[model samples]
Target chain A: MPHDHHDHLSPSGHPYRPDQDGPLTYWQAMEIAIRELMVEKGIVTAAQVREQIDAMDARSPAQGAAFVARFWTDPAFRDLALRDGSNACAEMGFEVGPMRLIALENTSRLHNVVVCTLCSCYPRNLLGLPPDWYKSRAYRSRTVREPRKVLAEFGTILPEGVELRVHDSTADMRYIVVPRRPDGTDGWQPDRLAKLVTRDSMIGVAEALPATEAPA
Target chain B: MADFAPGARVRVKAMMPPGHVRTPGYLRGRVGEVERVLGPFPNPEQLAYRRKGDPLDLYRVRFPLGDLWDRDDADTLEAEIYAHWLEPA
Candidate 1:
């Protein structure tokens, strides 16, 4: 998608600085010229970049939802998923690169929220790209200092006595919150149960919807 | 660093090395219990710079929210930090 940089970039080709009085700055023009030269020389192809982007765009929270649904219905699968999330995700045919994937279980006594204080590192294969808010300065700073308040902002009001556990995704380790299965989901199949799990729920900002609210 | 198991008291070293570090600045110098050892992994700090290096042990440490900040109402904070940045509490 050849997006219009008009809104984000100044005429000078800088993001905000418009000191130059040209449509494209010298560096910007040089970049385009070099890119065209490379493509003309068959050094790199534009198709390759688009293909990578399309692959990324194809991933969504549905993958994580499927894993959670399986975990909810099968105790053995739950053990496997909890023990090694990377392996579980791999079994489902998702490529989670090399990082230790840990599934944090949210029970009646605890709630888990994942964040990367330094950068927005996430399980992109399972959960798609990190949301804008997840990468914001406000979230990165406030989550550790005041988790309850942050959760409240996300409309996730925890019950009294439940300790909110914030997991800082600071290293080569990723986290996914396997929220406590909602009540009244008895005998629910994985497909039916998957509908109740949302992206935010897997991130620990919300809970799985009640079965009644689930889609038919 | 290898034998640091769950329930072990560990403190995040206050030292701040230059260049890319995955450990958050806030948790530095804080004491916490090792919730779980997350297994040995390549040193991300080195890997990030494209340097091949040996793996380092990583652990999931849990710190009390009250201890990290003045807010008594905050809940616990857990983070996965590399073993090199930790010490016996």
Candidate 2:
């Protein structure tokens, strides 16, 4: 039997679920009502809503990886990112909406991790939608209180000398952890270096992939 | 005008208002230093009620993990807190 990819997988390669086919949730019902009202009232069109969804769906971790790669290779950009994350991302052609972004740099002595203790506020415009675990109650509650334990759950272990800094996105500001560039990629270009910058690394769950492990 | 400047010691006010408050429960009454003054932004509490929230000064406060928890490590935690939820410590 031939396996039809379209029937089982979404465009992003994740398994597709028949959400609309299932019993409509309360939130989904409310969303439908609001969208219909807005469209009927000429506030917005269905086309515009679809376009917005398409725009958001287009964003992914690849964008953040590119920014990290640039930050690693360019000294001036790195300084700018540390000073003003929004502007630095804009300089790289990624518009991060209205929310203020703060770039946390990981050094030999310090490691930075970001979590939204109050809610699942993330740098969505830069890194796309957060993973399901990021929005879980356990992650939101424990990451601030027992971050070392949470990092260990993600298979990340730091040395005794390295200090960990957890940035809780409690309010309006969003955060991005600039994981330290791996060794042995001294003269690698940003495009190549981006392959080593994984999504988990940017979230501070894990370090950047080693230079030797970068995709060929 | 900002009430607290960067590096100023401040404490998260231990308030439990039953609305859209941004201050986390664990941080209430906890003391920390203002890492930076992030300028005024619309207060989320008021905005949640569909009111035009008057802008409030927001600050990044850094607390030592030991102070936050019973941990022996030297890790630290930073959170963005609105000025209204903070008091001079």
Model number with the top lDDT: 2
lDDT of 2 by residue, A1-216 (tens): 244646687656667666666788999999999999999999999999999999888878898999999999899999999999999988988886889889999999999999988779989877898999999999988888889899999999988899999999988898999999999999999999999998889899999999989898
What is the lDDT, from 0 to 100, of the residue A199 in candidate 2? 83
Q: What TM-score results for chain B in every one of the models?
A: 0.92, 0.95
TM-score of chain A of each: 0.82, 0.86
lDDT of 1 by residue, A1-216 (tens): 233647776555657745667599789999889978988999889897678789888889998999899989988888988888888888878777767689988999999998888888888878998898899999988888888889999999998899899999888788888988999999989999999999999999999998899987
Instruction: Please state the Cα-based DockQ of model 1 relative to the true two-chain complex.
Output: 0.80
Please list the residue runs of candidate 1 whose C-alpha ends up more than 4 Å from where it truly belongs after superposition: A1-44, B71-74
Model 1 local distance difference test score: 0.87
Badly placed stretches (over 4 Å) of model 2 are A1-23, A41-43
DockQ values, each candidate: 0.80, 0.88
lDDT scores of the candidates, listed in order: 0.87, 0.91
Docking class of 1: medium
